[model samples]
Target chain A: MKIHEYQSKRVFAKYGVPIPNGKIAIAPKEAYDIAKDLGGKVIVKSQVLVGGRGKAGGVKLAKTPEEAEELAAKILGMKIKGLTVRKVLIDEASNIKSEIYLGITNDREKRMPVMMVSAEGGVEIEEVARVSPEKILKVHINPLLGLQGYQIRDIAASIELPRKNWKEFGVIAKGLWDAYNGSDATLAEINPLIITEEETMLAVDGKMLIDDSALFRHHDLAEMRDLDTEAESETIAREHDLAYIQLDGEIGCMVNGAGLAMTTMDIVTLFGGTAANFLDIGGGANAKKVGAAFRIILSDSNVKAVLINIFGGITRCDEVAKGILEAIEEVKPKVPMVVRLVGTNAEEGRALLADADMITAETLAEAARKVVAVAKEA
Target chain B: MSILINKDTRLLVQGITGNEGLFHSQQMAAYGTNIVAGVTPGKGGEWVMDGKVPVFDSVKIAAEATGANTSVIFVPARFAADAIFEAADAGIELIVCITEGVPVKDMMRVRAYIDQLDTRLLGPNCPGILTPGVAKVGIIPGDIAIPGNVGAVSRSGTLTYEVLYALKQKGMGASTCVGIGGDPVNGTNFIDVLAMFEDDPATDKIVMLGEIGGTDEEKAAEFIATKMTKPVAAFIAGQTAPPGKRMGHAGAIIQSGSGKASDKIKALEKAGVRVAKHPEELPDLFG
Candidate 1:
């Protein structure tokens, strides 16, 4: 659910946060046009959801339209952290007086949205927290009462901001909070909230991560999902309502719950096999969904075997077995498959899968051992 | 002798007219939970589950009519926060929310709002409490566990069942088991249930199942080291999970270099709790 810097800035601007005028460009010509409009001094930033864009040479400063075009062309096709840069943001470059970091995120211990500010900015906040430890200031916001004026002032003063900039800083902080809460974002951050030569505050960079469970309520944010940065199998799994994450291994795993799914993956590893992916069919998954999950698992070329484990509580194992049969009929998979069904209707589920060309086990330990051995043989 | 619910507990189901609510309501009643009433907002004046439990328009009316002191919610995620508010407002002391996908923001408010009252909320996305061979509340299958001396608390549903099944095979059964949900924000954490299990006389030993996510496990380990006198066995999943990947559960992710399975396991071992590398080894960790 991570959005590009340009999209985050657009959200920040809507909440009255001051941001440098920028345009997202997909091609060199568009970058040239945007650079010219910004008076030919701009920063070309690659728009990839993953971090470390600067370290990857995906960000460059351009002095003229020609330089902007060249940098955009170079960055547009470059890969940062395995994600190809499809778009570059051309923004007006500003003269900076100082930089600060401001962010709003959920504090798991506090169980509330916490606003954090640091005097050290334009760098990863984790590094700052790890090294200095005393530079960052945090305040928990009451979800019922929200970020108050006093809390903002306290953060501003603690960060050693000049009294002159406190008012503008407060506005930007409030704006950031609104954008974060309004969009159901788990994280909303502005790195280097810079003080310009004119003494005005501007957000130089932005990052936002929306909560997936809350996406049903925010359609606008949901459409902002970037597919290029995501694994194709993951996107397909999401469409099928299956929680799937691609991993590097030989065995593909499908289980009934999140906790059990992870345990299944762990057991596979403990038995000397690696799980290719973690897939959860979730609660109340039917035959179609189960079939879709099986298909998704086999779609990975690296998967040498498949393991299906179900502890049917709300999910009936017989339906899962039927779905496996349907998928085997369609996919005609070459890989070995192991099935373990337990809980409600488990005996019936085992009966349904008795004739299939797969190994059946009575417990997870046996299933993991068998799946690993079969995968190594395959 | 169990922690949360027992024979005297009068249970009410929220969203009782819905598919999940009706199904689990019947399951709970069949498992010997005292069925009192149900609340579905618009479906009042009707009796569900073979004309035994009455349906009311709201929790207030339902609580007043049935004298129900505990509730299990099956409402949808969209209205789940409101349902919690309604349940809390109606003076239900112990509320177990079986609904999943409740937004974190709503839970934050629910947490704050409930803290002001006398309520002890269990989960917004969890399988509810179970006192085996006595009363089954939510979605945990009724047949797997038997009533005995071991107290169990976990952050998963099927994984808990797996552990319970293993314990049963070892001739060990649970006094009470609680699934605290795997959401980033939970109403009851491991420490809360650990303290409860420590106080319950029917429990002799405790078993905990945790996955990588927040620092709840580390904190719970700290609590176990400092507070509890009972012997504890534990298991943590997602050891093979890669960094920055959400492993099924919303809370089961390793972020900011924290919430690693290795770290949680180390903390638990350091606290003198036997840690199992795999779920199958969990039953043997008790010694």
Candidate 2:
């Protein structure tokens, strides 16, 4: 649900947040044109979903359009935090008077959205909160009342902004809040809300994470989802409504729920085997979905064995067993499978899988042990 | 003497005609829950569950007509908060919301609204609560839940079932198993449920299953250190989870100073609660 920085800035600009004029370029020529259009002296930033792009040398300052093209050429194919840079953002570089941190995120303890502001900016906010502790200002916003004028003023004052700049700060903070609400964002951040040489504020960098659940309501935002950062198996699993995350291990796990899936992975590790991936078939998954999950697991070349653990409540165990049997017919994967089925229709499910060439167990612990053993042997 | 529901409980199912609502309603009723009525907007005057349960158009009419004391919501995420609001407005005291993906913004409002009332809401993305052998609310598998003296509370649903099953392996069962939910802004929390279980006479020992993400577990550990004298066994999942990635559950993430598994485990251990290294080790941890 994380959008690229350029995309985030676009959304921010719509809410009247001042942003340096920027353009996303897929090639060096496009980047050159963007820098030229911005009168050169642009920052060439590699566009990737993952963080640490700057530390990874994916960001460079260009004095001219040719330098911008050269930096874009270098950054476009560079990998930052394991994600290959497919696009580079060419933005007008501005002189900064000062930087400040501004963000809105959910507070788990307060069970509400809290706006966080800090004098320290252009760096990790966590570092400021952890070390300085007193630098950051937090304001819990009521969902009904929203970010009030007083709340904004309080944040501005806490950040030690000059009285002359308070009104402009108020506008930027309000714009960020508006963008956050408009996009159904779980986290809206503008690190280094910079004061330009002209004393005007501009969100030089932006980050936004949209809520996946609320994506059904926001069609335009949903289309912005970057699939390149996602694992191939994960994308397919999402299509099947299964929760899947790729990992480095020998055992592939498919469980009924997310919590149980993680536990399954942990138990497999405890039994001396690493889980290749985390996969949950979700609630009430039928034969087709379960089969899809099985195929997704088998698709991972590193997976030496597979484990299917089902504690069928509303999700019938027999249906899961049927799905495995059906998937085995199609995929015909050579990897060993260890299944532990319990709960509703479990006996019937076990009976259905009895004649199959798979290993079955009665308890999750036993299933984990057996799968790890089978994997080690394989 | 369970913490939440018993045989005398009159249950109302919101979004009753919906797939999850109808399915769980049938399962719960079969397990001896006194499901009095169902509330599905505009599906009033109809009968469901083989015409045994009455359906109402609104939570207000449903509560008035059926005298239901407890309600479970199966509405979709978008409408779930309003469903909870309607249920609270109708004066239903005990509410369990099974809907997942409710916006945190909506839940904040829902949380504020519920705090003003006498009602105790369980989850917007939880498996609800179950008092085994008496009344089963929520979506935890009833058969795996053996009724006994151990009070179990968890943030994850299937992991809750896994622990209960493990406890069953040790010849232990639960007085009540409450899934306080894994959402950042759930209505009820571990500390709230821990307090309830601490006071419930039917509970002797307690089992707490937590995951990384929020500091709720650390808070609960603090509460256990101060308030409860009950023998507590704890297990935290996502120990090996990658940092900052949502581990299936929305709330199961490890961020800066947010609930980290190692921190929670250490806190629980220091608080005299036995922390299980692996889920299967729970039984031995208790021993």
Candidate that would win on TM-score: 1
**Worst lDDT window (10 residues) for model 1 chain B?**
B278-287
* Model 1 residue B209 lDDT score: 95
Q: Write the per-residue lDDT of candidate 2 for residues A1-378, one digit (tens) a residue.
A: 999899999999999888999999999999899999999999999889877788899889999999999999999888787888899989999999999899999877887788998888899988788789788888988876788999998887777788888888888889898899878788999988998888888899999999887898889999998999899888898888888889999999999877788888888888889999888888888999999999999999999999999988778999999999999999999998898998779999999999888898888889988999999999
For each candidate, give its TM-score against the true structure: 0.98, 0.97
lDDT of 1 by residue, A131-192 (tens): 89788898899999989999998898788898999999989999999999998889999998
| DockQ scores for all predicted structures | 0.83, 0.66
**Regions of model 1 farther than 4 Å from truth:** none
What C-alpha lDDT does candidate 1 achieve relative to the native structure?
A: 0.92
What DockQ results for candidate 1? 0.83
A238, model 1: CA deviation in Å?
Answer: 0.5
